[model samples]
Target: MALTLHGGRPGTDYDAAWWRSVFGLLGECFPGLPGGAATAEALGFPWADQTTPFTLSEQGRTVAHVGVLAHPMRLDGRAAVVAGVHAVGTTEAWRRRGLARRLLGEALDWVDERFALAKLHTDLPEVYAPHGFRVVPTHRFRTPPQPPAQVQKRLLQPLRHAADADLLRSLLRLRTPASNRCATADPGWLELTVAALSGALSSGFWHIESHNAIVALGEEAGGALILDVIAPEPPPLAVVMGAAGAADRPVLWSFSPELSCDRAEAIPTPPEAGVLMVRGDWPLGEPFGISPLWEH
Candidate 1:
């Protein structure tokens, strides 16, 4: 009699109040909440009807929320494209309970089998392993980018309201090819992101001609500034150097303690590392059962 499950998008019974609760819960756990109402509103996100926001309620009141997005991710081999997970959270009052587990189980059941892998980045691995999640040690890079000198840059940052959904979708397709994450980015996603990004790390977008897609988040501790999602061949440092500019502005990236690539600098710390976990199937497709055809 305590729990009842239902499907609701972002602004149903799960509107601003519910989101306020969820974001506050995150603020308690992490250093800061990345994209919340304040940022979303400023960015002009069309949040009343955002996609991929599903909730779990108690007596019709939302207690938990999580959703998926199929953003573009780069992989090692010929794994095609994939969908990804984003903005997953549960209310603080509902913590330590099996509510999240239940919600995710139900959510995955409907993710069909078209995905090569169901992917999500998480700092908590032990909590997810019991649900058949595996660990792929990964890095979350953050740096005060140093854009090339005399380089031309553009500042056409799009908020959620005026965001190009198809273009963002296309970018995701190009970024994470083999992922099975549903697309969580709507106008609101970018709206919220752009709004939050300007203040993100005190450094904003540092576009480098035909080279990078740089952007910033708010001036908070947990905020992030993304420099580039370049081809494997491009110099990884292009983003860092570009974002921080020639002055070496404050910058950092989160890389798993066990993961490695190329780093001329390191700020190794336990809290900085993260493990990637998938709640459902990998290469999320029929063989694994997480495709768009069977969506919830």
Candidate 2:
């Protein structure tokens, strides 16, 4: 039988059997990681509206795949649309057949027609270099913890019910980028997925009533870590820390706190941490880290 190529949005185009095939492919390719489509479905995330996928199949079985997630982002304080390439994989039986490269070519050609900039997170930069992606430097912000500044004025509440999730979903829709340098405007889906996967969605998500913000925070042996912050207008770092009960310990930021860069040291992200690659003229500035919310 001849091989076939297919393209569509995951939410709408994928039927149950089709998803099973994709899931099987993902299981074979990714091993222990949760399938992206399954995770999104479990969380009621609207991925079909956000991502476009292309696949190659033989004998009604998916053999290879590539996905592009469209994102509204802030690049150098300017609004831009970015294409996030993800989920590239090939079935074991199809290895060395160039199926992955073919799908990548098709997906990127589609990206080039509508988007000027594209990005992907990967440990293997060599795989993508020939396709126009180059490594981009990223940094994490760090500051020593301080004593409690003042009595907390804001309250942190977890998403305990459907109402809370709804509230969080609403807030996410209105959220602005935490950084004007390089940040995502709609990070809700990825944020929720990361939280769910890390077991933080239940214990770490907190909504600040007074400020109308949601923070993914956790206390670790080393310090208090702020994973991601979602708000219409992000409050000052102190306010966020105080509300999340990080007033007295060292703080590490996974995302760029664009406003507070001067107060914290910017450290080069070790190569083993993760690699960021880009395929367009990168915006100029001190290298900024994207929120883990964009990690997909």
Query: Against the unseen true structure, what C-alpha lDDT does each candidate score?
Result: 0.43, 0.73
Candidate 2 Cα errors over 4 Å, as ranges:
8-11, 31-36, 144-146, 150-160, 218-222, 243-249
Q: What's the C-alpha lDDT at position 262 in model 1?
A: 35
* Cα lDDT of model 2 by residue, 204-244, tens digit: 76676667777767654477667767788787666666755
Best by TM-score: 2
TM-scores for candidates 1 onward, in order: 0.56, 0.86
lDDT by residue for model 1 (14-103), tens: 556766655554455443444544555554444333435556766656577666554433233232334455456677777888777876
Show where candidate 1 strays beyond 4 Å. Answer: 8-38, 41-50, 77-81, 139-202, 209-226, 229-243, 246-271, 279-296
